[model samples]
Target: MCFDAIDMRVFDELRKLEMFFKEETRRGCSIIDLYELVQHAGNILPRLYLLCTVGSVYIKSKEAPAKDVLKDLVEMCRGIQHPVRGLFLRSYLSQVSRDKLPDIGSEYEGDADTVMDAVEFVLQNFTEMNKLWVRMQHQGPAREKEKREKGRSELRDLVGKNLHVLSQIEGVDLDMYKDTVLPRVLEQVVNCKDELAQFYLMDCIIQVFPDEYHLQTLEVLLGACPQLQPSVDIKTVLSRLMERLSNYAASSAEVLPEFLQVEAFSKLNNVIGKVIEAQVDMPIFGAVTLYSSLLTFTLHVHPDRLDYADQVLGACVKKLSSKGKLEDSRATKQIVALLSAPLEKYNDVVTALKLSNYHHVMEYLDNETNKIMATVIIQSIMKNNTRISTADKVEALFELITGLIKDLDGNHEEVDEDDFKEEQNSVARLIQMLHNDDPVEMYKIICTVRRQFMTGGPKRLPFTIPPLVFSSLKLVRRLQGQDEGQDENPFGDESLTTPKKIFQLLNQTIEVLSTVPAPELALQLYLQCAEAANDSDLEPVAYEFFTQAYILYEEEVSDSKAQVTALHLIIGTLRRMHVFGVENRDTLTHKATGYSAKLLKKPDQCRAVYSCAHLFWVDDQDNMKDGERVLICLKRALRIANAAQQMSNATRGILFLREGEPQVTAAAIQSLIELINTEMQSDSSTPDPAADAFFASTLRYIQFQKQKGGAIGERVYVLMFLGKRNVENLSAYWFTTKSFTTNLMV
Candidate 1:
């Protein structure tokens, strides 16, 4: 290590030197006066230190002798033979001269020879520093290896400063970098044969040079990989270089064609190829790691180039398969992850790559062990294909899906369903984008997906078919307005230019999925399709699907709970039907209400019938000012409620009476009180004949309820208690009106 634990006495001396120079420079001492002070200082090390300090003052003053002062200081630095002291003295020299050193092409600074001398000066200091750094490791006790390494880490930047200064040179073009700079730097890296030095120096080289210079001299840079110490990680160096090149591709994408050119990947491949072959006994994992990093870079730079990625991955798959190096599970896992990296990073480009090279790579990875990688590849491919929204791409998507499922053990049957759910979603997204404004194209893509499902066999269809159907239905609703009862014309409207074709595709999906084993799935999909059809105003199609659901419920569906749900779905669909004329809607409403009445459980029948009763009476829309049918529905609902109540099923009966009982009893008493009060208060000299008759009818009903004397009697008494004062006046008025009518009749 260049740095050591400084004795207190030595620290005090260095501190005094630092302070004296600081004070002297602040006092505006002439550079000549400072320079002569170095000459007069007796000892060699102190003289060199004072010379370097005064040299900085000279350079800052812009004096002519600053160069002379720097040159003389470098010459005098050789006097310190002790490694630790010499390294620190050189570090001090590099720091002081860093800014003042002549940069290339600077008219005020020195010429090329003078600049080279400065670089050489820093390089010579670095070489000696490294030698000293390595020699310090053995000087201490063998047990001190841990402690020695700690000290060496602190002082590593001292040696690295030379490389930093070299990179900082201005106007050093490709020729200079390739001819003069690189050879000299590589000489040091090669001669050291030390892992730490080689790794650190190589990393500095990768970072400090311009990417174009690396591009021009990629061979030289990569050629040094094989010469590195065995412990050196060549991947780090290669990875940094590749990153620089990829950024070059990004920043220069508009102007330069070099990075995007096909030959770029080949060049990268060549460099990595040499790196692998150079080391005869390189661990297969190590070689795989390099190629993996290179593949990622290839994708990043040429993301639009399918062939380049294919070529790179083809080599990787070949190497892994031919060598049989994927022995352990961990290594195989790593390789799988590495090969999957390009898909994760460049998802948008995967579809194009799939069109060209994905299948070739899949052919090699076509086994059960590589199922995860295959899945990852297919998922990325499908995602991009969907985003592009071209119908022609649908066939390729299914092909990839088929391949992925085939790779799964027993065609994905043995795998957990969760694993295939994401792929299914991707297919759904494809269906979503598959529809553009063209309905015929939409039909073609949907039919293609349906056929693929049929070809894939029936076992997985129930799980996978719903998304396709759902996506199709969603496509329809989005094209047309989602509301079912709207008056907007969907057939010729520009918003949904082809509503008929969307309807046809939906029907086609339903017809295809009807034969699957999962009847519950069929029921759910049919219900969805019917509602979507209603929303689009395809009422006849909606009725057709509704009928299909009823058939499923009656025949295939055995679960009582499922049957209840299906019945509710039928009623709900029927209720949304406003486009059908009065006669048609009334007929459908009657059918739904009848189905609700026929439910097995008495409570379900009560609830379903009561809910269906609302469909017969639409407020303000029914022109016939008659409550005859409403009364009929009320009577049937009352009967069902009575049946449920007689069964002594507390939970079941409460479901009906939650609203029905209070409404029925409240209406009977409230109507009588309201009619009697209104007819008596009007002193119109002539009584309305209709009000007379209505008053008679309500009084008769309440009188009947009062006579029954049970729960009904209690409700009637409660109603009468609230209107008792009004009831007395109403009874007197009713008797008088009745007597007056009788006299008139006589």
Candidate 2:
């Protein structure tokens, strides 16, 4: 019968009997006659149980020497050879006699009794119970062996309880535990040759003892580990012990000296190695888990010793190297945890980078796992706000996370698009975190990032390269600030440290990104760099950037809307540029107007052409303005707007439509009025005939719209009214607002 199915009431009856013995003893019953019951009872199991209960009370009563009573009862209980009955009977004896042992201050400690006697009693009982428990495994038929093992496992606590009792004894100090208690218990655990018992009792030894005792007696406790049955989970046993010791070390700062005094880490390190060597059949997962636990212990106990942490990683690397790459999910998961533990502890990836074998251990993980680990490494950097400041450090960081940066070994598995993008985007964000206080060094960092991200293929270039471009531009601004009053280069490297040279580098990087066919982003970056150059008064550099943008707009920007937007940006950027001489300014402005005129949609072309009128007229600087060119741009815009209106009317087959007035017409009217105002304000006493003709044609168009007398005419009248208020010397013009209003009334 299983131990669980046995009549629990039997234990109740035993409790009743135990109470009876206690009452009888208190009432001064015959203690000698009570001891005689052992020899006279029918069943040996019942008789031994009764004798132990009575012996407990008899010892407590102080009628006889407690040592003699304990010794007689222990030897007498050995008669019942049945495993189940023997284990329960011994468990009963242990229970009833727990407080009655002849330890130091106990009632039975007088005369020849001592703590040793108590130790002897518990160890002897522990040995017998372990033997009986191990024997139960072999008693059943081979087919029922598993069943008997299960039964034996349930009964293990009954056996382990003795060690608990041993640990609870106030008299058993570190000396006694090291000398007698630990060794005797390990002897039975080893000699029993049962996997279940060895596993359980070794764990019991670790748990039941004080950490100080474990720390002091680590060698003795760890020495018995290798002697256990081969199938025993020695790794789990050792891991638990190390975990406990680590916690103990972490519990008090004062206790660490003792750990070092005992060479705790060294002893654990050696024993784990020894255990791995002895347990040759252990799986790689188990070995790695053992190293992981040891790492935790080291981090807790010897957190300052990085070499020790590295040494643990090195050991893991060696073990993994011998086993080749770990394909097992559990092993790889453990390896990731192993690598991440230090990151979490220090909350710094830079510190993790200092460990030599940190990345070496990662080499054994598969690609997907490597990506996961790489992501974790990046997260550590971001979470800790760690700055990877040097070029070499950036290079090292990229190397560590190469799996996320690019495809390795040409593995073509289809990655989820969003997931891949997110991973690469994290790499991009990490790029921004790469900073150095030195401008020259910061330049080198950007170069290093570019070199690394260039290999990320076209898919990653869009995400990764823009940060480099911006970083390079940022470096330029810094160098310019440093060069404020100095003629000589602040950095000795003139070729590399100069703002112009860095712009060249940015041009090259953005050029590469453009080849990724990401023209829009490329164009945006180019314009940004151009603006920065203009701010720095590097006119030639600014011209080159604008040139690159124009080339992209002509060659790559195919969408009509994109072209319109690009042209507006080009015109707006050129309008703000002050460093450009007339030649470069006009050359770029001509290209901008030409591109605007060539847009796919007429409305887009008309609006872009009108917007380009600003490029020809510079309000902030004098020499860059060309009134004639501005008049020409306004005329060209008016013509395009009229063409676009004609096309709209033709397409819709509607004449003089009041609703849905084209935006281009209003834009042209606005630009024309501004240009006429500017011409009137200029110091030219005699206006050019072309400007006069342009102004006359605009007035004629307004009169034609006013004749229609609808929304278009009202909008035209409003435009003329606002223009009359702003234009100076309005009497100089042939067309006046009053005359137009008079014509409207008539």
TM-score of each: 0.62, 0.86
Residue 700, candidate 2: Cα error in Å is 22
Task: Provide the overall lDDT of each model, using Cα atoms, as 2-decimal numbers.
Answer: 0.62, 0.78
Poorest 10 consecutive residues by lDDT, candidate 2: 650-659
lDDT of 2 by residue, 102-213 (tens): 7777767876888888999999999998899888977968999888877787888899889999998889988888888888888888888889999999999889889999
Model 2 per-residue lDDT at 625? 49
- lDDT tens digits by residue: candidate 1, 362-448: 444435545555556556655666353445676665554565433343554465677656545544444554555555566566667
- Deviation from native of the Cα of residue 107 in model 2, angstroms: 2.7
Candidate 2 residue pairs in clash (backbone atoms < 3 Å): none
Against the correct fold, how does model 2 do in TM-score? Answer: 0.86
In model 1, the number of clashes is 0
